[model samples]
Target: MPKSKITETLLNSTVSKYRNLLKFCYFLMVFVVISCGNDTKSKVSADTNENATTETETEAPATTSSKTILFYGDSITAGYGLDDTNDAFPGIIQFKIDSLDLNYEVVNSGLSGETSAGGKSRIDWILNQDIDIFVLELGANDGLRGLPITETKANLQAIIDAVKAKSPSTKIVLAGMQLPPNMGQAYTTQFKAVFSDLASENKIAFIPFILKDVGGVKELNQSDGIHPTVEGHRIVANTVWEVLGPVLNSEL
Candidate 1:
């Protein structure tokens, strides 16, 4: 072979090998860059997921503890004639409290035909549970029965004393009552004064007359002419709420 032709062939082979080497290096760099990008994305996605999980694990639910309002009364508080006792004033008040998002539980500890003397006897048992607010609604039956005014007053006072002794912090709300004219002018007058006098003496909250607008109104009362109808109870709830609302709000 001629020397010039052999030299040209060798140079051509070397050039081809150098070009192939350059191409191989470019492909390896491109593969490494793509792999590194994919690994970075995976790490970022993993970090985001871990942060989300940590936040969810650390988060807590909100909770609230409910206080109690106890209505210690007679047939009026018991919703005697109503099909559902929820229509009673105490339950209506509970609905109002819930609507306002106030955390309070209303307990109606009323008994049908409960009188001042009866209330005095059973007060200790009712006081067994904690009472944030205590509403006393008695003496109406006593007045209706034409019982001795002095005895009724004494019984109610005893109940009040028992409550104070049991829980000094418990707020007492004295619900006043009045007797119909048939009970006698002097007797009725004395009965009406009983609640007011006790309230003043004890320095407690007082409802002048729990029945207020509902008492003498014929439409308000049920067939018994004594126990309030559902509508009547609603009105009574409003009257009670006027006084009770402030006390509850103060606690809040």
Candidate 2:
């Protein structure tokens, strides 16, 4: 064989090997770029998933359901002697709830001068209700009649228990009352403590004194002094609304 022909063959072989190595290197560089791109895309996808979950969690709190409340009380709650339906606390509360767009209603279960025994007797009628919240407002009549404090406490406690047993999910708010000074401090204290104790023992909610800062005010009281006037009802509604508003999550 000619030397020149042999040298030419060798050079051709080396060139072919070098070309193949160059192509392999080019393929590796492209593979690395594709791998880095995929890694970046995966990280972006994971970040997007985390952001979506966080957004859903943040929105959950705004979608909670609002609660309903029932107004259960006596003449004072009944808007006794107020000649108009809107003059009652139920009416007032209804208006407030409406303004705030709360899913609630105020069931006015008021009776005039009803004693605790009467309340006990009529309890089933009251208990047989689909109430989410109960404003336990009784015992004023019992206090007026000089009824036994123990009796009043028992009746109120029974009502509270019944509400819990029946509804189980219903929240109780004891609208507390205080006796007139003429009743004497000892009896007054006992009468007042009836509600306080019942509410405390049951681990339920309470309104320190429903008529606080408004009960005996002449302008706020009705002609009877015991009952509230139209203006008085407004005050009472606001008083009851103050505690009840937060419990029911009702606006205004």
Candidate 3:
């Protein structure tokens, strides 16, 4: 072959070899870059976990039980239509507190069909004496009977403010109740919010929705589908005691 032809062929072979070498180097660089990215991501995750651990460690300590609580309100609170000892949440709560050997008395002040207006009327008579804590479980009947949320809220506010005024040291807990779904969404939403709003304003503990687990279940409620059965009451007791047992300091 001629010298020029031979040189051209040699140049073509060298260019092909150089292209292959360039591709191999590029792939190695890409692999190293991916490895570095994974390491950086792992470090960030570790740092986030470390910060979370430190935040939890710096959180405040929990407070122990402080005082006795009196259960006050309407029919459900009063144990309406339930047998003397059977299916009564108040009775069940009393048993548990005694069993736990806690220094809190479960005082039953439930009045059947009692409205917020009625509670206001008898607040002076029913509780002329002092109390360490008050569990307000009203507004169920108000919502059930389709009473105005405004009136219910006002009555509840009055009762809480009265207790605060008379017994400034008392810790109050507001037990929430949900109005029936049939009562339109607007009304139900407002009614449900009343307890939380007041509790927030007063800096009190709230049960959110007391009848949550008790309501709707066929076995839990009685024939009326309104009152909870004895077993249901036990569950209710557990619910209230969950909140009540922690704050009580001594027997009432």
Counting clashing residue pairs in each candidate, in order, gives 0, 0, 9
lDDT of 3 by residue, 71-102 (tens): 89787877776767434787787777678776
The regions of model 1 sitting more than 4 angstroms off are: 1-63
How large is the C-alpha RMSD of every model relative to the true structure?
Answer: 7.0, 10.6, 21.3
As a TM-score, model 3 comes out at 0.70
lDDT of 1 by residue, 1-252 (tens): 999999999999999999999999999999999999999999999999999999887885566667889999999999998999999999999999999988889999999999999999999999999998999999898988888889998999999999999999999999999878988898888889999999999999999999999987899998778889999999999999999988887886
Could you tell me the C-alpha RMSD of candidate 2 in Å? 10.6
Task: For candidate 2, give the lDDT of residue 11.
Answer: 100
Shift of residue 167 alpha carbon in model 3, Å: 0.8
Best by lDDT: 1
TM of each candidate vs. truth: 0.76, 0.70, 0.70
lDDT scores for all predictions?
0.92, 0.82, 0.83
Query: For model 1, which pairs clash?
Result: none
| CA shift of 59, model 3, Å | 50
